[model samples]
Target: MYPAADTATLLIDGKWLEADDGATFPVTAPATGELIGRAADAGAAETDRAIDAAAAAFGPWSAETAYARADVLRRAHDLMLERAEDLAVLMSTEQGKPLKAARNEVRYAADFLAWFAEEAKRVHGRTIPSNRRGHRFQVLKQPVGVVAGITPWNYPMSMITRKVAPAVAAGCTIVLKPAEQTPLCAVAVLALLEEAGLPPGVANLVTTARPEPVGERLLADPRVRKLTFTGSTEVGMRLAAGAAATMKRVSMELGGHAPMIVFDDADPVHAAKGATLAKFLNTGQACISPNRIYVQRGVVEAFTEALVARTATLSAGPGTSPGVSIGPLVDDAALTKVQRQVDDAVERGARLVLGGTRLTEDGLDRGCFFAPTVLADIDETMLIYREETFGPVAAVIPFDTEEEVVARANDTAYGLASYLYTRDLGRATRVSEALRFGIVGVNDINPTGAQAPFGGVGVSGLGREGGVEGLDEYLDVKLIGTAL
Candidate 1:
């Protein structure tokens, strides 16, 4: 009962398909390492078929009226809400986020569909004054054509929908390759789109463990005019470089090392609670998780105490278990990375203020389990502060003045999201301006939404995922001039 009986198949050309080579890959529960099921392991041959399908469907899909596209997206949005619980369970079972978080993710994911549905109707063209007499000039927004998307396992559903919805809304056809680990959820979501009147070949999906060679097929074909991806920064750079050969438009949402600064004027307890939510959300696997937490010296002790207390309450276990706020890491590799960071932090003289060991007792030995950890007096030299600790670990560094903290926070190569909690509006505004991140939350930790432009600057990658900017990524502009 882990997933549907036909989970081990691909979605190509509006039909569930088996890999031509009959290859399959195993998908296991992150909590128990139990075999959920296998998914079709699409190779280059199957990959080409999906791309061909998207190319075939692009003409019809892009030619449809904006209202027609909106109708299909709106129906998909309603169906997403109707099956929210089921999708949540599928995400929790495969991706290891808590069921509660999973429920929230699907709801959030559905918003993209709804937002883009309305946005589709508003893809208005603008008229331009022509320099020549008796001539009219206008600019048109048209779909960029066949789009290829590759998403990571951390955000199985939302990432896929965020890319697919806008592309579909913009009148472009899509051939999506979701992360291999979480393909079932992709299958379930694609089913909704198909049921909601998405025509055959308008949207296609292929799953495989080896995304490199298979995903390269998407970039290799000139018919795929755009490539949208969300993953590590290193891979994003590679994909961007690959797409350049064919001059395909690429949207890359890559790595992030977010910073959260807690000033003395802010409520220590409130900031601590927000830190807990932001740090341990999705077991810190999110790209926008706060990697470094800066505390003003005046209230460092109070904030630390409250943060430890809040973290202590979170129980790590299977995502579906009752009262479990935290769940296993996605796999052993993630666990190893967390362990390495913690070890390095300890070796660098940081104090472990709370739990830091692996939770092997109490029936969690089989899965990848690490206790939620906190390290204080962390410096920028340490790996926990320098690199992304994509686990349930928080790094705390104490600071004094606003200028000093702003410099410290902006002293990173990757600039994605940053947060600051301060009642002093002047300080908040000043520090936010100084920070080099794309998205800054003055007092709120939850800064991203379906209607907001979610993206980053610098090595964090290019393009936005939400809002009107996201819709524009799948569209190309054309200038038309006519003699009157």
Candidate 2:
């Protein structure tokens, strides 16, 4: 069972205190439409307080030895693993992912903390050659003061860990603004950090119902030296513009309409299984979820049949339910968006082969549950074909040649991730290189790990989030010159 929702207070300056005005908002479970709990609703004043706390703590925190920071992160990682089961259940309740998937997310989140913990000691700088005699040059890497982390609800636990771990490991303090829909998980995570011995004011959390007061203030504040956000492209663009006024460093992991290309040489069953897992994971709420499928014309019919069979095997219900593969959408708005996209696709002449309607039967009427949907004959003109569905809906488009498929896949404004399935070594190397995405999974659906860099290009946003590069996001370079 999951722990009770944390309704005490927001974490600021290393203390748990109520918002200045004591305002609160209700957090409801998407699975059952039940009230999870009420969370502190921090506004402008609370946001400013968190920022001030992070700024005040930044100097001392950044001055600490890398080993010191690494110790704290390691403790936090151990604590998270010890509490993984509870955290996973909490994630399933608040974030609406299946229990199994939620458990994996917690494990994945812990890996980031551990990875960054070791990486803390390895942040290096080098000596530069001087142009003139009697002159010496050296480069040093240091923390970038206070940071504002804005994360989405899709991967609540992992997103927080991904940003917070690296920021702390890099010796930077942070004010985290978690998605309001899943603030309880963020609260739980903050509690773990505190228990793991994070110093006061080094990490803070402010949850607000309104973005203008909290989110906007962080973006516009000069005290926040960096802004790292993971959410929609629309919001990322707005944050980028606002952050520019203060000349703050920015790292954004925005939206993605990832394409999965299945070649004729690939086994139909294996390709279908991979596509199913990729598309339906987390009920397809992932930013990097495969939104579009391009099958070679010669194998399109067989692949479609296999995909329909695989999709039909998935069980959609509450996340806590046994044997449920797909879970509810985050809210009514998400449900409506998915429904609208499917309807538009059908209206544009795409055929729904598998599941297409909302699941209201079997005690799921109150929740935001959508069936695992598959659409065939999808063309570029269809709304589903052009947009990120962000749901458990896959639109399959047939292509006659590899060149044609590559061109169509790269046509999107978003370039976060792409996937290709083939046994041909030459084709794998060629197509993987041709794909204009930050990450490409050839013959594999899951490409993310602690050792690899994760980010995107084009409208998908800027900067990397994992691996050695992720830690660098919170650091700045300083050049020292000496003349004798």
- Residue 36 in model 1: lDDT: 87
Across residues 1-484, which tens digit of lDDT does each residue of candidate 2 receive? 1135355558888888767777888898898989988888888888888999999999888899999999988998999999999999999998889999999999999999899999999999999999999999999999999999999999999999999999999999999999999998998888888888889999999987787779888987889999999999999999999999999999999999999999999998899999999999999999989999999999999999999999999998878788989999988888999999999989999999988889999879889999999999999888888889999998899999989999999999999999999999999999999999999999999999986899999999999999999999998999999998
Candidate 1 deviant stretches above 4 angstroms: 1-8
| Deviation in Å, model 1, residue 393 alpha carbon | 0.4
Residue-level lDDT tens digits of model 1 in 151-222: 889989999889999999999999999998899888888889999999999989898988887878998899
Candidate 1: how large is its RMSD? Answer: 1.5
